[model samples]
Target: MGFISNVTGTLSDSISSELKDQHLETFRTDSLGQDILVKRAVRQNSFGRNQGSSEIISAGSKVIIPAGTYALMIDNGKIVDSVTEPGIYTWENSSSGSILSGGVKSVMGDVFDRFRFAGEVTKSQRIYFVNGLEIMNQTSNESLHLPYPDPVYGTLYFKFKIMFSFRIVDPVRFFKKTGKATTVYDYMGSPALPKQPFTEVQDHMEEALNLCGSRDKVPFPQLLSNKSKLKDAVNETISEVWYEQRGMVVESIAMTGLTLDEASRKRVEQFDSAKIFADDPAALQALVALGLTKAMNSAASNPAGAMTGFAGLGMAGTVAGNIQNGVSAFGGQSVTGPETCPFCGTPLPLQKPLEYCPACNADIRSYFQGMS
Candidate 1:
């Protein structure tokens, strides 16, 4: 029912010398790649012919488990034993009284009970190897829309392209969920494999992105640099579907691209332009000067008359010139002094002391008075 570690000179007691010579052969698998998740083991007959599908594994068959792979001994469509360690294993029939008398029960008692099978009577058995390496390059063409809240720019929405990888941490659970295939289970390439994990991750991506951005207070431009937090948030979001049920966990994620839609881009540009002028008074004064130049050019070509246009231009120039003095002359509108609100920087709305800022609702009375 289970495999015992192979020891020299011990097969003669359980198997006849002639039978051992015919049946005892090593069963080992080669290194598996990221795409291949599982592979069924095969054997050859005494005539060196391939035993395909209907071969019965005789007692005393040696199975070698290499590093980064797990082997399972299945009998009659049920998992009888499994080997996670890398070494040589010899199959010992539990029904054989001679082998069980030598304290083989202590070796396989817990494993046999785990699957609720006392022993396997028939020789309908097979060996399978599971790849334990990290499967990489799992990509999704679907774009995830992340709504990121920026303290300075309000909420900005963006689309992101993410690439992620996963590894099988619990082979037993994974094998149970995805049973034995004909020969190989191609996790990445096979169309027969279910696309639950990929689809589920994408389905939950938006929520995870929101949680990551909001919880960590990451700005919209910094989401790409915060890939680690995003990855953790995504894994935590889909833990029930991907990790708990499928025995697979996301190993790493790389954010390939982040882009804003046209509308969002225009909004950001407008805000960015405003911030540049607000942060630097010299920049604002330069913009006002440009406006004055355009007005004078339009006045010279005015159809009313050169003198009449010049009169209008003089009034516009006065208002433009006052921009440098932190106040506008037209309608006596005050251009906020250099001191703006510390929180939102919204010019403090005429610099009058107020209890709260109307833009961001921050208590600005103390801050406004201190600046005044």
Candidate 2:
């Protein structure tokens, strides 16, 4: 048979064959002129042959030329391979040409190029503000009113210097969920100025500390005695606030230092003084003793002095004696002793127990007996 007639006969036979029974095969030539077979289903325009050095025309088979390659001719459902370089080739669908081109390339070669979709990345970290830590972020004028003004507030400016660290956990989720690393910054950073102003996180921290202080009604001196506990309470409250509100976990919070403003410091010092005097049983007892002595001396000097001054002494002595007896009953020491005549060291009698010294006959007791 002649070359043209033979090719036509083959084409007719292939075209007439049932597609369900016969499968079509595709081939393309490399730069080395090696024929490589690519298997695909037979379809319209599935055949082609090299019509020229740079082109192949297919009449029934679809073909994939590499990104920078060309096609020449087509015939039947088989590809007549003829080419001049190493590149990707696939059987293209006439209806969905090159739809699976990448798939074919991946099958034939290593598909190492990867595409990833990322949204946002977020990181969480912990900060520590040690006890007595002075925070620099707070403005000098800003102040918090703690419930126990004596222990925590009163013209006191608190400042703390804190250490903070952060790390990324769910990078993709952080990016997608939060949108930026700064989301955490915004969550933790100081709020705006003027209305909220710049208060150290430690200020809030201290406030939380003072909230726990409310559990005790004792004075500041008593609270300060357990300063370690105060610090722990502060750390706990601040950490909880951060975790619950911002969805960030706290690793550690410490207070590096604690300070009191000048005015508050002075007030605290004064309070300390008052506390010392108020708490001293000995001093209180001495005051009571002196007053009783004075009344006894007076009664002794004025024989008929109506004894009113001695009456006050008698009442005070009774109350003091009862207090002493109660203390002794409780295994505690007595602060005051018996009321006596200042002139002779003799025990006095009340008018109700005659408020006068019988031996020295003195009048000496006029004084305030309750807390001043």
Candidate 3:
């Protein structure tokens, strides 16, 4: 019995060596998590008669073997007892012994649950947001002091601190597209602009400013005064430009700072002061009345001017009354009020009749009566 056991062990070792020498079996796991075992038969090599230099084989390549699990096999021709552990066994003929069984068993283990990927914007990519606060310096002369630099004449230098938030909507797609998680602004930082600045970004800002019009006409500030409208407009604009154009989403755009040269600053200040004068309530009203009178006279000259002429006249009269009211109001003359609060002797609210004290609830009737 001892001799027989020794012979069997020796034969098993030989069989294992033979199977390993000749590529016999292979296994592969599919993407759907299925394992496939492949078997290939050993064939004569037609290449050269020299038995082909002790052909080295790896586990997954195919080769022929006697009816037994040979390549990477576990228990000798038996079903694996535990599903967690897999066994492959091979039976081979040895020169020393007739029948030999050799096998290997292993517990298949997994460390990673699933494959993952990270993504980022490439250096070639350019990203930016539309700023509604930038307005066109529509003055004919360049000396009018533009808020932004004129690329045509001077060296324009500015830094933009863009803020954007993005979430991975499609992990696979995002990984395939961008390749890593990174902000688009990171890509913009490299390759400092000396010879050729970001003219494209400047152009886009100009376009946005043009779309927004002048500061007074811009709807952003006005909308921002109302939180609900500001949010809605911001969301709409961001989605339209960022997502629709660049496959990105901008959550918000804030014009945090603006700078201009000393000359430009002085020019802007002068322009602003001139604008203030031009937009003075009394001045604007006077201008509107004059324009309306001219339009009324022009309408009156026509043959079918009856309706239009009367409408023009009504518009002119209304404008004139508004101008007079504005001038009078600006001259410290109240439309309807006592100069002082009746009960508290404080300055009364301008342009409205005072009946009672809003703060103290004191009856102002006696005070008004005393004034009369």
lDDT (CA) per prediction: 0.65, 0.37, 0.35
Which 10 residues in a row give candidate 3 its minimum summed lDDT?
106-115
What's the candidate order when arranged by decreasing TM-score?
A: 1, 2, 3
Model 3 C-alpha lDDT per residue in residues 1-372, reported as the tens digit of each score? 997886666555444443333333222221111111122223334443223113222222322222212222212222111111123322232111111112122100000100111111111110111111112111111111223333222222333322222322222222223333233233223223311112223234443433333322443223224333322333444444434443333233333343455665565566655676556656556666677778777777857767877776775665455455545555534434456554443454445656775445677777766766
lDDT of 1 by residue, 1-372 (tens): 134433222332223322222334458777777657888886645666432224355456678888888888887677888888898888765222122235344324322332233222223567889887877777766667767666556787778766888887877788898896522234443333336567687788777777866677776767677778878888899888877887778888876777888888988899989888767667777898898888888888999988888898887665455345443222234434445446654444453466875446788777656656
Candidate 3, position 322, lDDT: 44
Q: Which ten residues in a row have the lowest lDDT in candidate 2?
A: 121-130
Off by over 4 Å in 1: 1-22, 43-63, 75-121, 140-152, 159-162, 182-194, 254-258, 300-311, 327-372
Residue 249, candidate 1: C-alpha displacement in angstroms: 1.5
Candidate with maximal TM-score: 1
Q: 1 or 2: which has the higher lDDT?
A: 1
Deviation in Å, model 1, residue 255 alpha carbon: 5.2
Which candidate wins on lDDT?
1
Clashes of 3: 14
